[model samples]
Target: MLSVALGFAGPALAWPQSLREGLFGSRPSDGRQFAAPPIARYVSEDGDVFTLDRTQPRPLLKFDNSFEVWALTPQPAPRGDTIYKNDLGEPVLRATRLGGITIFTEQRPGGSAAALAGVGSPLRLAIMGPQALLERLAQASARASRAARRLIPFEAEATPASSALIADSAMITSEAVVRMTKRADSRHFLDRILKVRLVEGRKASAQVAQGVLEVTVAPPQGLAGRPSSDRIVQVAETFR
Candidate 1:
């Protein structure tokens, strides 16, 4: 049986040995790039294994206590992207497409702006925290809470995409499950439904899930009412 014990050693899941060995290779478009599909596998702490064939946005693990989420792209990003960093000097490693959407190879989690541009989109994000395993429904709820609020105080010109979506949604689904394994009591289980709403970025909001930290964008409306592909092309061509 899969081990759900709080302190026990997690499962040992591994990608095909040959596939794992072949992942870190170069492609023709750029000398420093490589393709990310056909064989990328990330295993969760509970031995749940996720194999990447193409770039899909999904979490790596979900359980009653803890979880891990991961997003992968097929292309490689370049080396000099500024979206990889925040004003605080922390590094971000997921790519989000607002207008432009391209995926390069070398941009694992942090690529240079110059490198990231090749892949399209200026925003990239990744959220890894203690409560990473709530499943998609709960994750969406958390995201909606964080995205529904506005980040008035700004230190930079850019805004985060995930935060915008959450703020717009406002209400999070209450049915989503929140699982927990208490640190004090390993055998005990603490499961509940978490409802979150963004009150303040720096200060605590009226609604929030305890033990969960969120990473998201500032302005919540940037991604709303996104234009169609044809409209985007027309606009780009008009500028040209």
Candidate 2:
């Protein structure tokens, strides 16, 4: 289990304001780089523990027995939501601000512990306050509601070459379809489903028939590296 220490001064001070100040504020009053106490602590699967401190203008990671520190700068979120990606460009660490509290998730490649131990790997910790946890649960509930309401069912045969299921419908954008197929191919079955549920949310639906896969999706919302309609359409047509 991972533990987090939120440096809250008092109950009167809102967490969002404090979190922003800690993450993006100037040096502390004492002129030291890091705060007196760390904001969070993470224990890797290898049993190595790390700490995150809000040191002047950025966050710093410190490990036991190592004087060296890895500084992390905030990166812009892809969709400009409360969710933010780290500087690594991969979804290493995602910090999401709900209302008062913030939520953090550690995203490792293939969700492997060894991969998480790589140099500059994001901290594998989930720090959630009561409000933050409630926010997540609410968002999840909303997604489930939307999925139940808008799900579309269909049937199509799987292509022999790629084993990709094909569904032909103008209602689904080519980019959305192709991206969904690629996601299905690349990730584990459960992971693929969860990814779609989180990203597409109410925007798309997918299911499999006897020997085929079926999908229904709304227009593309410009996910990273999504191809143009012409190219995606061409690829989708080839499946049949």
Highest-lDDT candidate: 2
Across 1-240, the per-residue lDDT of candidate 2 in tens digits comes to 111222211122222234434343345677654322325543444445445544334454545433223335566554443222333333333432211113233333433221111122332222344444334334433432343333322222222211111111211232333333455442233122222211122343444333233343332321111122333333334342
User: Candidate 2's C-alpha lDDT?
Assistant: 0.32
Top of the candidates by TM-score:
1
RMSD of 2: 18.2
- Predicted candidate 1 versus true structure: per-residue lDDT over 1-240, tens digit per residue: 111112212334333344323333334555544444322333322232333222222211112232221222123345432122212223333333321112222233333221211111112123322232223324445443343331211111122433332322221121111111112231121122123333223321122245222223233222222221122222222221
Kindly give the stretch of ten consecutive residues in candidate 2 with the minimal lDDT sum.
162-171
Clashes of 1: 29
Please give the TM-score that candidate 1 achieves against the real structure: 0.24
